[model samples]
Target: MTAEILQKVASEGLPPTRMNARRLFGSFSFSHQPPYSRLPNELLSEIFLYATCRGVDDRHEIISTPIAVSQVSTRWRNVAISTGALWGTIIITFPISRGQISRALTWLKRSRSYPLSIFLDFRDPSWDWDLPESAHPFRWQDMEALIRLLIVHAHRWKQFELLTDTWAPIFTILHYSRRIKCAPILESISLSRCNAFFAARNATFAPAEMKVPIALFGGLLLDCLREVSLTGVHVDWTTSPLRNLTTLEFKYLATDVTPTKDQFADILEACPNLHSLTIIGRGPQADSPPSSSGSTATNRPDSRSKKSARHVELMSLTSFTFGFNDMDYALEILSMFSFPSIKTLALENLSNVDPPALQSLDATPLLKRLSFLDVSSDATTTPFPLSHIISLKLYSISASQATFSQFFDKLRNLEYLGLYNASKDVLEALKPSSNVDFNSSILPCATLKDLECRDMDPETLLKMVKLREAVSHLGHVSFEFSNLCPTLRTNFLDAGIDVVVQTTAQ
Candidate 1:
C-alpha cells in the first residue's frame, strides 16, 4: 500500500499536494484566530467609536478611521458601518471634486441623526498665486456646492467652521444661511480669513471692493452657540447673535472699521456667562490709505466720554487677552470691562502705553498667569499686585534690572518663570551675587521651581541656578542657546536639577 501511494504522488505533480496542504493550514489558522477577533460585537463597536472619536482635527485620521477598521474582516466591516457616531465629523476642503462630495454625502448618510461637526476649508492653495490683474483664482462653484449641501443639514450642525482666503465665500454662505432661523444644537462657529500676510503686504488689495459686509448671520440666532471666533472678519455687533457665549475671539480686525465702544459693551453685556475673551487689533498696512480721524473716535476719550463710563462686569471671565498697535486703543477697550475673576491676562504690543493702564487692570490679586509681550518699562511702571501668580512669561521686554527686580519682588509665590529676547540688564538681575547669602538675599520668588530662558548668558544662568539650589527651590532649568559647555550641563545634573538644553539654529 505504501508503494502504491508513493507511485501516485510521483504520478501527480508535487504542486497539487502542496496546494491542498496550504489550504488546510489557512483553514486551521482562520478557525483559531487572535483573541481580539473573538471579542463580542458590542465591545468591538465601542472600541471603534473610541478610536475614531479622538483627534478630531486630524483630517487623515478622520477619513481613514472608518475605512481602515472596516477593511479588517467581514464582521468588522458590518460593525464599523453600523456605528453612526464614527462618521459624525465631515471636513470638506476647497477645490472639491465630485468624488469628495460623494464621499461626504455617504458619510452624512452613515452618520444618521448624529449632530455633525462640519469644517469647510476654502483656503485654496492656488489663491497664493501672485497673478496679474486679469486673473482671478477662486473656486466659487465648488464652494457654493459644498455650502449648499451642508446647509441642508443646518439643524444638525454642532460645530461649523469656515476658513477662507477671501471674505466673499464667507459672506455668500452666511447670506444664504440666514434662511435657517435656528440651529438648535450648534455650539461653536469660527469664521476666519486666510492669506492674511498677503492681504497685509498688498496695500492695493481691498477686501471691501468685493462688496461683502464684515458682519454675518444678521437675522439668524443660534441659541445654543457657546463659542464664536472671527478673524479678519467684521460682524455687526447689534445684529449678530452674541448671547450665551463662553468663548469669544476677534483677531486682526479691519483697520478702517471696528465696533464702537458702546456696541462692544452691549455685546459683552449680552453674554453674561462669557469666560474667555481675546481681541487683537489690525496694525496699519504699509503705504495703505490712512484711516479717517473719525475711525477711532469711539475708542478715544473725549469730553463726552463720561457717558461711556458704564462698565460691563465680567464675573465669569477667567481668561482675557488684548493686543493692539495703539496703546490708547488698547486702554480704551480695557476700560470697558472689569474682570474680577480673571486668572490669566496677556497684553501684547501695547508696550509703550502709560503705567496707568497696567494699574487699571482689575483682578490683580487673582491673576495666576501673566504675559507681557513686546513691553517696555516706559509703558509699565506700576508693579502688578500678583501675589498668587505662579507662572510669568516675558518676551522682548526692555527693562532695567531695577524694574525686573521690582516686578519679581511682587511675585512671592512664583514657581515658573520664562524669559525670551531678554535684555542684558534683565539677565544680570536674575544672576544671584556670589557674595550675598542665599537665605538672606532680598531676591524674590523664593518658591521658584522651573526656569526657562532663551538667548541667555550660560554663566549668568548657572549663577542663578546655583542661587536657587542653595535656597532649595530649583527643580528644573531649560535653556535655548547656540552652544553650552558640557561641563556646565554635568554640573547642573550633579546638583540634582533636570537640565534641558535646546541648541538654537545659526
Candidate 2:
C-alpha cells in the first residue's frame, strides 16, 4: 500500500487532501532519519548556544543562528526560546538600519533577565569624512533609538563596547543617559574612534578636537570595571575610578588632555594591580617634574641623585608597549615608571629616537619577548639588555651585517626570530662563512630554532639555514618572497626542516 501510494504521489503531486498524504507517510516505517532529529531538547539548545558563541564576529551568524535553529522543528523553537543565554549577546555591526535596530531589540528582549554583552560598531565605509556627505547611511534617530534601547538595560550590562568614527554621537548618548549611574555587573568598557579609513588610505589624519571632556556614568565610579581602553578620546580621569584596573590602554589621545608625568604617576599610584600597559602617540612632555607627593627613590642606575624622586612604580605590570612618532617623548614616559614585573616589551618607530634613549630599558631584566618596528640602524648599535628575550621580531628595520651579527650574538638564549622587509646586508651577515668552522665562529643566535624572513634572497636564506643547521638544528623556516626557488625549498625539506614558502603577488 505504501509503495503504491508513493508511486501515485510521484506520478501526480500529493493528493489535494493534505490528510491523505499525512496518513500515507505515517504508515511508512522510515529507517533513515537525521542524527540531530533524535537529540534531546537540552542537548540541541546547548549546540545552538555553542554555534552562536563561536561566530560572535560573523554578522550573519549573530543574526540568524538562533532563528535558524528554532525553525528546524517545533521542539527546537521552544528550546531556543527558553534558552536565554543564546540571545544574550547583541552585536550590531555597521550600516545599521531600522530593521537591524528592531531585530537587535528583539534579541535583547529574548534574552530576558540574562546579563548582556553588547558591541555596537558604527564604522561603515560610507561614514568616512572623505566620502561625500550623501554617502552617509546612518540616521541620528536610529542611532539614538538603539542607544536608548541599550541604556534601558544598562544596569544589566556585563560588557559594552562602542566604536564609531565620530565621538559626537557617543557623547550625546552619554549626556542624555544621565539616569544610568550604576552598572553593577559591567566589567569592561572600550570606546574608540574608527581609524580604518586612514589606515586603508595609508595616510595620517589629525584627531578631531572635542569641545568638552568626556565623562561616563555621570562621572560616577564603576566598582566592577576592571579594563578600560580609550583611543582618540579624552575623559575626566580625576573623577573616574582607576584603582582596580588590570589592563589600561591609551592611544592617540589629544595633546591638550594627554596625561602629564604627574597625572600619569597619580594613575599608576591608583591602579596598584595593573598588569598590562600600552601607550601610543605623543605622551606628556617631561619638562615638568613629577610631584613630590608619594614619590619614591629611583632604583635606576642612571639616576642622577640618590634621593631623586621617581614616578610611582607599577608593582604588577608584566607587559609594556610604546609606539609613538617622537622617540624622545616615549623615552621620557618610560623614565617615569619602573616596571619590575615587565616580561614583554614592544617598541615601534624607534628609528626616530637616539639609541641611547633605549638604554633606559636596562631596568627590565625579566623581558622575554622583544619586538622592534621601524628602528634605525644606529639604534642597533646600542646593545639593549635583552639577553633574557627568547623571541625577537624586527619589522621594516635596516641594519648592517655586523650590527645584526653582534645583536644576534647578544641573544644567546633566542629561539624564535622574525625578520620582515629585512635588508640584504642583514641577511648576508646571518649567512655562515664557507671557510669558517661552525664551532669556531661565534654565529649569531646559536640557539635559534625558528626563523621567519620576508622579501629576502632565497640563496642567502638557504645558506643561512644550512649554516644555522650545521651549528644548531633549525626546526622551522618560513619565507614570503616574490619568487621562491624550488630547489632551495626541496633542500630544506630534505634536511628534515619544516619549510613554508609563500609567493607574493606583484
Candidate 3:
C-alpha cells in the first residue's frame, strides 16, 4: 500500500490546505493494521518539518526534502504539504527550462504567504561572457521569465542572493522590481558578480554600470535590513546610506565604484549596531567624494593626505577585517572609529609598511584591548603593543625573523596561537628570544594552553608543545585537515597533549 501510494503521488502534488489534509487523513483513518499509522497529524507534521529544515542553498535538495517525504504515504503527503515554511527557501541553480520553471512555480504556490529565502547561482567560471549569442546554453527570454516570476512575489522575499559572472540578469531583475511598493520585511540581500572586475575592462562590451538605488522594491528597505554582502558590485552609497546593519562586507570592488570618504563615514555613523565589517581592494575611496550627484568617478585614493577625520564610538562592533592598498589606508579608516569592545582584528596586505607607518599604528586605539590578532606583515619594526591579546593567528608565506621576534615580544599573554602554512625558515624563526642559561628560566609561550597550525614540521611542533605542556598544561594541539606522522602522533598523545588531525580538509 505504501509503494502504491508513492507511485501515485510521484507525479501528483497535494494542495496545502486544512480541508485537503482532512480528506487525506479521513481516507487513511479507515485502516489500522499498522500501529504506527495511527499517529496524530500534528505530531507527524512536526516530524515532516524537522526532516526538511536545513540549509536549502542547493536546488536539487528540493526533491530530497519535502518532495521526497511527501511521497511516503497519503497521510505523510498531507502533512508535508500543509507545512508552509517547508517550501519557503527556493533555490535556482540550473538554467531556466519549462519543466524546471513549472516546478519552481509549484514550490512558490505551496509556500503561500511565508517569507522566502531565494538563491540564484549562475556562476560558471569556464564559460566566457564574450561568447556569441548562438553559443549560449540558455535563452535570454527564459532567464527573464524566471526572474519575473520571482519579482512577482517580491514582497515575500526575506533573504535574496544572486551570484553570477555578469550584470545582465541583475539589471533585468531590478528593472522589473521597480514596481514593488516596498519590501518591508526583507532583512538581507547579496549581489555578487564574480567576473565583474575583468568584465568591466573589456572595451568591446562594457556593460553599462548602474548604481543600486533605494527606490528599488519601492521605498527605504534599508530601515529593516541587517546584513549585506557584495563583491564586484556596489550600491549608490552617496545617497543610500545604510542604517541598523549588523554585518556588511564589500569585496573586489573596482577603483571606479569604491565608496567615497564621506560615504564610508556615513555608513559607520548610521550603523551603530554593526558586528562584522570587511573591506578588501583599497577599502573606501580616500579622496574627497564627488560634489555632483551624477558623478561617482572621484572614488579613488589621493596621493596627498586626508582633509579631516571624524571620530565615532561603536559599542557593539566586535570583528573587523581590513585589507587595503596601503598602510595609510588601513590606519586612516581605523583612526576614525573607536571600538571600546572589539574582540577580533584582522589586518592584511599592508603589513610591509615602513618604520614611520608601523610606528604611527602604536598610537591608534585599534591596537589596544584586542583579544584576537590576525596580522600579515613582513616589516622589521614592531607594529603595536598588544600585551592584552589572548589569541593570535599569523598568515604569511615568507615571514622574517625580525617579524616573529617582534610579534612574540608583545603577545606575552597569548593562551592560543594559530599558524598557517608554516615553512622551514618561518618555523626556525620561532626560536627563544633569550639564550638558555641556569640563571633565567623563562619558557616561550608560557601561558599558551592551545596551539593550532594548518601545516608544520612535526618534530618542531612536538618540541614546542612539550615545552609549553611543562609549564601551562597545554591541553590541545590541533592540525586541521592535515596528515600527521604516526611516530610524532604517538609522542604528542603520550605527553598528554590532545592532537587533532582531520583527514579531509574543509
- lDDT of every predicted structure (CA atoms): 0.64, 0.62, 0.59
lDDT of 1 by residue, 200-220 (tens): 211233455654453455647
Model 1: weakest 10-residue lDDT segment is 360-369
TM-score of candidate 3 relative to the true fold: 0.71
Compute each candidate's TM-score over C-alphas: 0.73, 0.71, 0.71
Stretches > 4 Å off in candidate 2? 1-38, 56-63, 126-142, 173-178, 196-209, 285-310, 350-388, 398-415, 418-443, 446-463, 480-506
List model 2 lDDT by residue over 235-268, tens digit each: 6566656558898888766455665556667777
> Model 3 misses residue 389 by how many Å?
5.6
Ranking by TM-score: 1, 2, 3
The per-candidate count of clashes, in order, stands at: 2, 0, 0
